[model samples]
Target: MSPVSSFLWTYAVGVKVLLSQLLSRSFSLPVFPLQNGKVAIVTGGAKGIGYETAKHLSRLGMHVIIAGNHENQGELSVSRIVKETGNEKVEFMYLELASMQSIQQFVQHFKAKNLLLHVLVNNGYIRWPVNQCSPGAAAVMLVPQRNTADGFEEHFGVNYLGHFMLTHLLLDTLKQSGSHDLNSRIVTVSSATHYIGELNLNDLQSRHNYSPHGAYAQSKLALVLFSYQLQQRLAAEGSHVTSNVVDPGVVNTDLYKHTSWLFKLCKWLTSWLLFKTSTQGASTVIYAAVSPDLEGAGGSYYVNGQKVKSADISYDEDLQRKLWAQSCNLVGNPERHQCAS
Candidate 1:
């Protein structure tokens, strides 16, 4: 093995073992019943934990809209959910999580339906580096740097900003379904990596220096902060929408398929040693969505079906407000709109 590879394996093996142990004993999963006539929107519901969550929710009888980047995968997931749950209400919508324009288009399409949004799962993410353009898209000079069409770092743009904008656009429908008062939920799928993150408000985009893990952590932390901020704002304004965040723990999913050879080896070891099945990984998300414990709770972070303390930095109100303002501008939703009376 290469020197670096050997070193990573040596160090990561013990860490993985410990993670597995802690996760297994931390908390037990909860069960929830779905209210009939409710509707849910799950972004990235085509595969992995997102697919599992959508399936479970569909089984509970909610009309589900599976929003994802890959059209084929989305259709497949919808078909699978329908077959498994025997609910023909499950459907798919194409959403390119990397593009703000695509997010807007998605909202416009949903608006045409004029249905209330009972739950919104902000679950899609991108984890690997990309070249500036497709090798065949154009013959122009290639830029090696990474960025999204919205000009933000790719991880933050897709994982946080796209969902941020989508939620903003659908605020009215969400309010209509219910909120804290009637059990409406906005579940942000955060990560345990947030323990290693500190939101540098001055460098939210990570312009000067970037680490994929670092950027991912920052985005997840932002999601937590945004959830809390939204909860507080809604309560203060007497709106019913409740927001919460959850970590799925380490799961054996396709997310790591893009890792380098060295990293892939480490991922394999980690999966064998520490990872939970995708169903277990998605437990916390489902818990937040339909658990009776969460009936009236708003702005909380949960893991393994229990409330947990978020990193101290995730509680920065000043940064939360700034991030909220930045998100509104980025998403082009200046004022949050309520349902027409």
Candidate 2:
């Protein structure tokens, strides 16, 4: 982890993303059939790649619900998409991914509407800087280690657990929509950083050895593991619901807003050269969600609209099952039959 090594690693990742984008440009996405009555939900849909994703789905005639914590941004995203797509079905719903209560409330509200959910895209994310300071303070300090309302590490809680709970709560609705047409999909946004992540089952919350980058990697690795497990469960039950993970290659998004100034400067210097636009970053997500070519595919990892091999560790069945059980326990649903052996 020397400075030079870090810079090299960053450069390599940037190159990989740029290559994926270039390769992706040669392919065209298949036109999804009319989705006039289908319902889709995109978390973190207020801005960046998520907003672009919401816009794409809305253009296909699906009723899209943009879920996020910011009321103003969420409403504005909805307005923009509606205006741009001329699809009035676009709307916004409040969601706070760090709070278990908020997730439950949002699910309840959606269920009360009696809507069948055809797509659930877990795209929200949070990344803490390597350092920070309290409001109005002149002194800077290492970012304090924190946990979510549910007592899990902040990154793991919001990035993986919250989405886990949301998906679990909406399982029935997703199944309902898939039962007839086999088009229901659950898309989880993951990252290439998962390759460097190691699952510490003993310290699931990173109580002892917590670094910002390590924690973020662990969260994304957990997401990929969850996606695979979910697909297995759906197939085991003979359900039509498909679950897949996507790597939206190196997008210039708000996920980096809290990084150090040095990091920001480096990124700004290379922005145009290395970073993918939000639209490009969102293309893989859109592909995973509605691609007719992936009609029956599950437990697959996709990048730039193509199936790619994930890190070797990501394919370990024991690790995937262990994470699945641990996540269910953390979410307070240990007795749920879906998680039973």
Candidate 3:
């Protein structure tokens, strides 16, 4: 997208978020009922909306694992949330989403504990500027390096594919944990930018032409597609698990730390008016996980604590299946049955 278009689209999204915040003034999700034995894994949960979501779940007596690559940040976040919520079950686990091997290790590590998982928040994300290296270091920062440790583009690799691999590996645990009353929840964080994304499945890696904006948008769109498809398969098999996607609205977070100085200045000046706080951004995610009304809800897009329609293209069954097959191939054939069955 052109700079003008990016700005306009961003502005429009900001306006919409602001309107929702104003109209819902004084609105807040009630404290979820205590969930003593439930377990949740929140990827990228070291900070921002992910951190807030973990903290909320912790306060409600759920065991919350904050998964991410940075050991120090992850540990510190665990300490802080545990301290604040007085929930001793909160802890940090290492999971690098940019590496499929790392994701596999994470699931293995979790399974070792012999615990059941009630919620999996695929919330870890890399910002848009992996291509932007420090001044005079552009040579080593070529586009291929922009691809993840695996060969996929970083946005798709970390943001979408890594989570895809994690979900498939853990689906059995999620199925076993869910019950007739409380379905297991798979929540993938997405964005409104997905609506403008033009996916070129023909060039999923953006090898011919690459743009950070387009790549990020495509990754998010792919996430929603995966989520909807996962729900469909689960429902067909008479499983108790549910999968859904969420757009947290524009929020002030580290996700914006890589943008240009001018963009940062504008955000700093207007964030209080236009942006959702990380806690507010996490509301819908927590709702999807524990809300009684949403126990069996699946294949839905959530915004601001409510269900809504996603882009029309996201509803395409053929497209969802095609992407799922391709993603399975990308991740490897060994794990296909985890999602397919």
Candidate 4:
């Protein structure tokens, strides 16, 4: 077997083993009842695990807003969730992850409602493999070294900076919701590939030594670092907002559709072996958002619903702050605007 195939076969077997264990234990999920009238916004909620999470949250009685790249998909997801849960509280909004203008517009629309935001899920993402120059536009792939229109790396721009700006814009609403309970949260969706990433202070955008996967890993690592740093900043400033990061555990999602054919074949093999269901993949996110166990926890990294030690690189305080600074610079928020301010 090819190395990729071998890996996939091993992964598939692992999944079966894990599933057997899960099924045998009669494991019951903990229920977290929403106390106040909570509102949640889930970016990229139109499909895959994000959609599952929105549906799950709606069933728990929280009003959910699905922010999607396409208006049609957003409407469809919202309609499905409302139909499934028999709740009219779910809604949809348009958000193009690639454009800062769209993000600003979405936030402005939310602000007009004067509603408090109890939870924010940074889940929108894309993974194109390489550049495809077309008429009047440069469509860069998700490779390690490429510049976005904003001049930051592509992965960094979408996965980290976009959410960074969105979170900043919605900070006031989060604070308003948490003033009553002090448990408001920012749940950042990261990935396990982060362990392989390293910080090259000299080339944060991978201008010289760019590898798409490597750059993507760096972005995810930065996300974990950002989560920790934000928590510390809030604590230092004596703010009540909590920030935590989680890895959904590999599942079959469209997040990888842009990968090369070789990668896709490998993924298919492994998914047939050890992949998670969309609902299972979303469990950690739900836990972070609602589980009383995390009521006051902040700056922690979670996987599959349990808090665990992250990769060593994820803890480098100097790196975390540096990454934050760079992210701020890239997003045009160089002043490091306080999320709770």
Q: Whole-model Cα lDDT per candidate?
A: 0.72, 0.78, 0.79, 0.73
Which digits, one per residue and each the tens of the lDDT, describe model 4 over residues 114-153?
Answer: 8889889987454222343221222222443556656777
* Candidate 2 lDDT (Cα, 0 to 1): 0.78
The total number of steric clashes, by the backbone 3 Å criterion, in model 3 comes to: 0
Cα error, candidate 1, residue 100 (Å): 1.3
Error of 3 at 290 (Å): 0.8
Residue 114, candidate 3: Cα error in Å is: 0.5
| Candidate 2, superposed: residue stretches over 4 Å from native | 1-30, 126-144
In candidate 3, residue 198 scores what lDDT? 63
45: Cα error in model 3, Å? 0.9
Which candidate achieves the best lDDT against the true structure?
Answer: 3
Error of model 2, residue 234, in angstroms: 0.7
Which runs of model 3 end up more than 4 angstroms from their true locations? 1-27, 124-145, 339-341
lDDT by residue (1-341, candidate 3, tens digit) is 55356445654654666667666652378767888899999987877889899999999999999987667677888999988999999988888777788888888999999999999998846332334432211111112327777788877777788888989999999999999888999999998878866667798887765666666667888999899999999999899999989888777776764455666686888788767888888888888878887889899999887788898999999999998888888888536666452
User: If ranked by TM-score, best first, what sequence of candidates would result?
Assistant: 3, 2, 1, 4
Q: Candidate 3, residue 93: CA error in Å?
A: 0.8
Clashing residue pairs for model 4:
12-273, 12-274, 128-142, 130-141, 131-141, 143-212, 144-211, 144-212
Off by over 4 Å in 1: 1-23, 26-28, 126-145, 179-181, 258-263, 334-341
